[model samples]
Target: MSKIRKKKIKKTNILLGFICILLAVLLGFILVTSYKSEQKESRHLSEIADDQQSGIEDYEAVKERAKELEEISSEEAEDTEDTKDTEKTDTADTEDADKTEDTKDKTTAASGIVCWGDDLINGEESNTYSYMTVLQKLLTDNGYNMTVINKTLQGGGTLSMMKMAGVSDETIQSYITKHQQAANGAQLNVTETGIRDLTEEQTTRNDMDCIPVIFMGYYGGWNHDPAELADQQEQILNTFQNKNQFIVVGTRPMDGSVTSEALDQVLSQKWGEHYISLADVTAQPSSTYEAQQAMAEAILQKLQELNYISKN
Candidate 1:
C-alpha cells in the first residue's frame, strides 16, 4: 500500500480508539451518576417511610414503594444477621459455626464503638437484634453521634478472638486460619437494617480513632475453667495497646462458675472502671432480641458513666 494510504489507515484506527475511549468514559459517568441519584432518592424515601421525615403527601405511590423497600431491607438484615448466629441460645450449638479471615486491622476509626465477641454478642440468626443492632438504634434514637460496629464472631471462642486480634500464640493462629464474618452478616454494622457507610464527619472525626468494645465468649470444651479463662481475657485486652480507648464487656458467666466469679473479677480489677459485666447488668444474659436490647441499654448506661458519649 502507498505511504499515504498507510497513514490514513493508522489515523482512522487512532480516531476510532479515541471515540471508543470517550464513549466508555461517558457510559461510566452515566452509570455512576444514576447509581448516586437512585441512592439519594432511596434515602429520601426511606426517611419518609421510617417517619424520620415528612411532607410527601403528593407522592403516595413513592411512599408505598419506599415502605416496601424499607420492609425488604429490614427482612434481609433480620435474616442474615447471623455472621451461624444460627444457635446463640446454646453454647454446645456454637461449635457448629465455621469462620475464617481476620478483621484486617485493629487500628480503627475513632468515630464508633468496635464490638468483638462470640455468639452472645453475635445474637441468634433468627432474631432481629444483636446487641450491636440494638446499640445502633439506641444511639440514633437517643441522639448520640457514634456508629456501632459489630465484629462479633458467631461461634468464635476466646482463643479464636485472640487470633482475630492477632494476640494469641502461633498455635491458635494456625488453628482458626481466618476469622468468621460478623454475626450481623457484615463486618461493620451501623444499623439494624444491614451495614451502612460512615458519614464523612463520623469517619474523619478526631483522626479516625475508634472505641473498642471487647466481649469474648468461652471455648466449647470445659468452659468452666475461670482461672485459665481470666488469663486469656487479660491477654486479649492488653492487645489494644491503649486501655483508655476501649471498653470491656464481660459476657454472662458460664454457669456463674466459668466466668462470673473468676473471669469478671480479673478483668474488672485490672481494667478498673473500663470494664462492665453483664452479671451486674442482668442475671440472665440470654441472646433474645429483648435481651440484646437490654444489653444495649446497659452499654449506654456504662458509656454515660464513663462519659465516652453524651446526649446531643
Candidate 2:
C-alpha cells in the first residue's frame, strides 16, 4: 500500500471517531433530560393519588360524624317526649287532688235548713206552732249545727207549685221578717202566707242544706184525681233534681177510706230512699201537735241518714 493512502486513512479514522463521540454525548444529554422529566411526572401522579386517598378518608369521617349526630338527635327527642308525658301526668294528678279538696271544704262549710211544706208542717191547726219548731228544738238539743228557717204555707199544693213559683228576693225577705217576728214572740197570721211565697223563699236561699216538702193534695184535700197529683209531683221532683239543692219528700196520712196506696207507691218509686211516710208515725189523717212532734223526729232521723245533717 502507498504511504500517502495510509496517512489519509488514519486521518479519516480520527475524524470519524470524533464525530461518533459528539453524537454519543448529545444522546446522553437527551436521555438524562427525558429521565428527569419522567421522574417529575411520576412524583406529580403520586401526589395526586395521595390527595385522592385523603379525600376519601375525609368523606368517611364526615359520614361517621353525621351518623353520630343523628343518634344524638334521636336520643334527645325521646327524652323530650318522656318529659312531656311526665308533666301531663303530674298535672292530671294535681287537678284531681284540687277537686277532692274543694269537695271536702264544701261539705265541711255546709249550713242552714229551708223548711218547705203544707199546713201539716206550718202548724195551721196548732196555734202557729208547727212541726218545724219541734224539729228546730230537736236539732238544737242534738247538737245539729244549722239555722232553721220555717217557710211552710197552709194548703200548699204539689211540688209543681213550688217549682213554678221560682226564686225571688221579696219572698226571701218576707220569710226572714216572719221568722224575726216569730223569734220576738209576735203572733203570725200564717193563713195570709201563700204557697208561692214559701217556694220562692226555698229556691232563693243559698245556705240551705236540706229542704223537705210535705205534700198532701191540692186545695187542702185528697179528693183530687190520683193520676193528676202523681204527675205534678213527679214534675216537681225532676225540676228539684236539676236545682243545686238537697230535697226530701214526705206524704201525710189521708182518710183511711181514701185509696192512698197508689200515691204511697209512686212516692216510694220516685223518691227511693228520700221518702218518709207519716202514716207510720201518726194514724190520724190530719196531723195534731203530738203527731207533728213525732214527724219532726222522723224528719231529723231522715236528714241524718241522707247525709244532709251530720249524725252527732
Candidate 3:
C-alpha cells in the first residue's frame, strides 16, 4: 500500500462524514418546523373549542331566563284574575244589600196609620159594642188597613190625650214612669208635659207617611172653658200644619155637652172636610152594639170622603 493512496482514502472518509452531518442537521430542522406547526394548530383548535363551550353556556342561560320570564307572566295573569273575581263579589254583595233596604221600605209603606188617639183605640176585652173592634172590622171589610196606638189614661184631658202619638209603647211607658206623681204629692203638670211631648212626637210623625186621627173632648169633662178649648184646638191645628201633618178631628159620642158642641163647631169650621161629628154619626147612648156599628160606618164614610180610601 502506498502512502498517497492511504491519504486519499482518509480524505474521502472525512468528506463522507461531513455530508452525513449536513443531512442530519437538515432532517432535524424539518422535524422542528413540523412540530411547531402542529403545536400552533392544536392551540387554535383548543381556543375554538373554548369559544364553542362559552356559546353553549350563553344559550343555556338565555333559555333559563326565558323560562323565568314565562313563570312571572303566568303568576301575573293569575293575580289579575283573582282581583277581578274579588271585585265581582263585592259588587254582588252591595246589590243584595240595596235590594234588602228597598224591600224594608216597601213593607213599611204598606202598613197604615202612624198615629191615633182615644181610649177606644186602646186594646181591651172585646164586646160587640167595643169601638175599636167595630172600627177594625169595618175598616178591614173596606180593604183598609189601620194601626192604632192607644195613649189613654183615667183622667187624661184633651192636652194629655194621645200625648205619645207615633212613639213606641216601650218609650211611652218609660216617659210615663218619669212623669208619674211622686209619693210626696208632687205631680207633673200633665197638660204642659203632654204638649211638649206631643210637639216632639210631631217631628217624628212628619217623617212617617200616614194620617193622625184624633178623638177629642172626652177628657174635657165640661170643665175646660169653651173659648180656651177653641184656642187649644187652634194651637193643635197650627202645630200640625207646621209639622206638615194633616189632622183628622173627631168628637166623642157620649160627651154631648155645650163645650163639646162648641168645640165641634169650631173644629168643623176650621177643619172643614177633616172634621168628623160623632153626634151626626150615632146618637149619645152609643154604648149599644148597633150604635157603635153605626159610628164605625160614619167614620168610614168620612175617610172615604177625604179620599183616604177608595169609595168603591
Q: Best candidate per lDDT, number?
A: 1
Query: How do the predictions measure up, each by TM-score?
Result: 0.47, 0.47, 0.43
Q: Per-residue CA lDDT of candidate 3, range 1-312, in tens?
A: 999999999999999999999989999999999999999999999999999999999999999999999999999999999999999999999999997777545433433433344454323443445555676677787777665433233345555543433334454344344444331356444542354434454334442344445555555522334544444444444434222334444554334445446667766776777667676776654445665567667666765664555322
Report the lDDT tens digits of candidate 1 across residue range 1-312: 999999999999999999999999999999999999999999998977867434455477688889999999998888876623655645444443321111213322246777766556442552456778778888899898888765555654566555555564664443223222223343421111122232443222231256777776543311344444555566655665444556777764444446465667776876678778777777655566666677779888777776667554
lDDT of each: 0.61, 0.59, 0.56
Residue-level lDDT tens digits of model 2 in 160-255: 244443534454345445444554765433322333444455555453343434444524222233544444454444433223234444453343
The pairs that clash in candidate 2 are none
Stronger candidate by TM-score (2 vs 3): 2
Clashing pairs in 3: none
Write down the RMSD of all candidates, one decimal each: 37.8, 11.9, 14.8
Model 2, TM vs. native = 0.47
lDDT of 2: 0.59
- By TM-score, is 1 or 3 better? 1
